[model samples]
Target: MDLIADILLAAGALGAGIYCLVLGRRLNRFNDLEKGVGGAVAVLSAQVDDLTKTLSSAQNTAAGSAQTLTDLTQRAEEMSRKLEFQMASLHDIPDTPAREATATPAAPVSAQTTSEPMFVRHRAAEAHQ
Candidate 1:
């Protein structure tokens, strides 16, 4: 009976050792960096870091664009105000063709220049008015 008990105990120990060896190999595969959960975690972490940098750069670019647009808007408003003032002054003046004709008397011509006769140009303009 003693011999049988010892043999049984040895067999149990051998079975336990085999089970432990198999479990250790499975655990090593689960933790492998190249083809396991560890590899997936590493890839995900790198992607997250890259996304964070991209988001930061995008925000900076937007802020710069906003500042530039604000400056352009202010400059446009100033130019518009100046143009409005000029238009108002023009509205106050009379639209008189005779006043323009008489303001500076025509210079006496010797009738030698043939490029264009001044009186003919003046007549055509007066016809338009």
Candidate 2:
């Protein structure tokens, strides 16, 4: 009976050792740097970093564009106000001015007419002189 018990104990120990060896190999593969969960985690981390940088740059560009648009809007409003003032002033002016009464009667214009129209062109250099 003692010899049989000792043999059974030895067999159990051998089986446990084999099981431990297989589990250790599986754990090593699961945590491998390449073709494993660890590799996927590493790739995802790099992608996150890249996306963060891109988002920051996009925000900066948007801020600059907003500032430029604000400046342009202010300039447009100022120009609109000036134009309104000019239009209001235009309303104050009369369409026709009062002509002074002449003592002598005006002569009638000639009835002569021409079929062809005439045009005059002046040179820039001659006009200055």
Candidate 3:
């Protein structure tokens, strides 16, 4: 009976040793820096770093564009205000050049004749003679 117990204990020890060896090998493979979970993690870490830099650069570009847009908006508003003022001033003028040239019935005919161009004045003098 003692000999049988000793044989059983030896067999269990051998089996345990074999299982431990296989587990150790699998653990080594899982932690390998190349072609394993460790390698995948390293690749992911590098990608995250690259994405972080790209995001920062994009944010900077967007901020610059926003500032430019604000400046342009202010300039456009100023120009619109100036145009409105100019339009109002044009409205204040009493008469256009065309209306002034035609002359109203209220003015003396002689005033219209005197205001004529030099060529017209000479032509009138010749006609009178």
Best-fitting candidate, scored by TM-score: 3
Instruction: Select the stronger candidate by lDDT from 2 and 3.
Output: 3
RMSD of each: 11.2, 12.5, 8.3
The worst-scoring run of ten residues by lDDT in candidate 3 lies at: 112-121
TM per prediction: 0.58, 0.60, 0.63
**Error of model 1, residue 39, in angstroms:** 0.9
Sum up the clashes in candidate 1: 0
In the range 70-114, model 2's lDDT, one tens digit per residue, is 999999999999999999999986554446225444434342255
Give all candidates' CA lDDT scores: 0.88, 0.84, 0.88
Candidate 3 lDDT (Cα, whole model)?
0.88
Q: List clash counts for every candidate, in order.
A: 0, 0, 0
- For 10-86, candidate 3 gives per-residue lDDT tens digits of 99999999999999999889878897898889999999999999999999999999999999999999999999999
Ranking of models by lDDT: 1, 3, 2
Comparing 1 with 2 on lDDT, the higher-scoring candidate is: 1
Error of 2 at 4 (Å): 8.0
